[model samples]
Each structure stands twice: as structure tokens, then as C-alpha cells.
Target: MSAAFFSRDIVSLPPSSPGMRIGLFGGSFNPPHEGHRLVSRECLKRLDLDAVWWLVTPGNPLKDHSDLAPLDARVRAARALVAGPRCHITGFEAAHGFTYTFETLSHLQKTLPGRRFVWIMGADSLAGFHHWERWDEIFSMMPVAVYVRPGSTRKAAVSRAASRFRHGRIDESDARLLATLDPPAWVFLHGLMSTLSSSQLRSRK
Candidate 1:
């Protein structure tokens, strides 16, 4: 099935006022789990964001798609997990046919000007962020919040993206100020931890 099948969910953009701080949390979310929720809640509280937009993608270009779930199903699953007016789940990537985070983020900033956008991700994704298209540009376009994940702290810390942007890393104590900071600013958050992962959940199925 195509993303068009869920026409009602192909959101143009979530409601927001000027100066609203929104966290752009993008992922395949093959099976949205507590781990995903943890990152969302952490970023929301720590970054003092007004909302967290979960950009459920069509598929991850860096991973095999043979096991990827249908776009509509994944979006539905995400909606069921993330609630409240502040947390939004969107399949716009599938609807707009965007396969790159850089493009999707750029589109959001262009269409929704005057909003503070921060890119949110788990440490695991940070470890391989360099493989993404124009990954460096993504850092240049918005502030970033990386939550520590099980067994990925060290790897993510020494990651190419982390090392390259080391000078821009801010202290976690100033996390609440992250949304207000300029591009290239990032902070590594700790405390919340979950062993749950989409891959492990998929394996059991």
C-alpha cells in the first residue's frame, strides 16, 4: 500500500505558534516501543520543547527494507504509543516521498519559519549518523539532542559525527537552553535508559 492510503494522516504540519520549540524525532519506528517513548519524553522535558514531532519515515535507507512494515501501520502504531497535543506522529515523509532527514528537516524549517527546531535521536543512531546524506548539514541547520542508549554511550561519544562536532557540544546542565541555542549546538543527555529496541522486538515476532 502507499502512504496515500492514509490521506487523513498526511499532515502538512502540526499546529505551532511563533517561537515554539519543536523536537524533530525521525525514525522508521518499525515497532514503536518504550525506548522510543523514553527519548521523546526526555527531549521534551530536558530541552523544554513545546512539542515533539515524530517523523515516522517510509523506511530507513541505511537498513534493509524487506522487513519494514507498511507506512500506514507503523504510523498507526506510533500514534497509539505517543499521545497528548504536544506529541505528534506524522507520515509526511512517506506522503511527500522524502527519503532523507536533511530534506525533511529543511522542508519543515522553510514551511514553518519562526519555530525553534531541535533534532532528537538516540545515541545508537548518533553512532552511525555520518552515513546519512548531508549529515553535517543537518547539524548546521538545527540544535541536536542525543539521549544515551544502552551500550551506545561510548560508541556514540567517539562517533565521527560526535568528534567532528565536539567543540559544539554543550553541558547537559544547560539542556533546557538547547532549543534556544543556535545551530551546531548539541548536548548528550543521560539518566533515562531502556534495553528495548525495535530490532529486538521484531526478532521476537
Candidate 2:
């Protein structure tokens, strides 16, 4: 399917149950592509999540917003790319007025206490997470699952956040258990990496 399918008012989506174990992959999907789908699929297969939620952010705090497409447009693009019973594209934060990852996690945790939530991200983001607002609070709130993206594995391994929380890294085989672990736990997944990126896609456009 094309990338135009995700364009919808996320506020209209139904609420998720608290019994589910979900992975939240938030980003400014200016244009969703195969890379985003691949990483999410890998996260589901390896981490055993019930579903992967693509939280299309209004804008990423770390990146300039000048190039970002309209939030609804990006959401639609993401929905079109993500096709499966296990995947969901949402702009819930926009409806909830959550502008930061830490706040989003906090809101979800409080709203759905029974569901286990894991923060899914690529190595590149993990590497720079230390600079995120309330970065330490995120670590203390939920288990993080980091997937190795090409060219980012090495730098992420030695990143300040990784080094500081190195003790929490678990074996790849145990990655699925991350959702059950206490806050601050994480795992590094190694597998096929997609070379496509949003920046590269935008530049070509």
C-alpha cells in the first residue's frame, strides 16, 4: 500500500486496553518508509509485543520542524506504510497535548496501569537520549528496547546513556523479557538493518 493511508484524526481512534503489552515508537514521520516498518517488525518479533504503536509526533524537539509535513499528513503516511493487525499509527499525544516522550510515558502509565509498556527506539536515538528532556525520568519509567541500526551500533554502545546504564543490558535471547523487567532495563538487538531513512527520503524528494 502507499503511504497516504495513515492520514486520519488520531483522536478518533479507540482507546487501547490495559492488558496489552505495547511498544511505543514515536517520531516525526514526515514520510514513512520501509525502514520504519522493518524496525517495528523486528521489535515485535524479538520483543514479543502485542502491538507496535507509531506515535507520530507533531514535531521532534531535537530536530528542526521547518521540513516537517503537516502532522495529519505524516500520520496518514505512517498508517499507509504500517499494514498489519499488530501495528497501529496514532497521534494520541497531539490530542492529549503531550509534547515530550517522558510526559507521554507518564500519561500512559497512569492511564493504563495494567499494560506493560516498552519504549522502542533505534540505536541512533539511544545514543543521543541523554540530551532529551527528562531523559533520566524515561529510564526510570519503563524498560527500553534498542534496535541496532546500521552505522549506529558502535556509537550507541559507547554513548553516555548506554555507558551509564550498561549494567542493564541483557542478552539478545532475553530481549523479550524486557517488558517484564523493572525500569532502567534494556537490551540491544542485532539483525538485518534497513538503510532507508527519513532524511534521505526527504532529500531525494
Q: List the residue pairs that clash in candidate 1.
A: none
lDDT of 1 by residue, 34-135 (tens): 989988988889889999999988888889999999887888899898888889998888777788999999998898889999999989989999999999
Error of 1 at 116 (Å): 0.3
**Which candidate number has the best lDDT?**
1
Question: Which TM-score value belongs to model 1?
Answer: 0.96
Model 2 Cα lDDT, one tens digit per residue, 112-138: 789889998999998898999998888
- Best candidate (score: TM-score): 1
Stretches of model 2 off by over 4 angstroms after superposition: 1-8, 12-14
Each model's TM-score?
A: 0.96, 0.93
For model 1, the superposed segments whose C-alpha errors exceed 4 Å read none
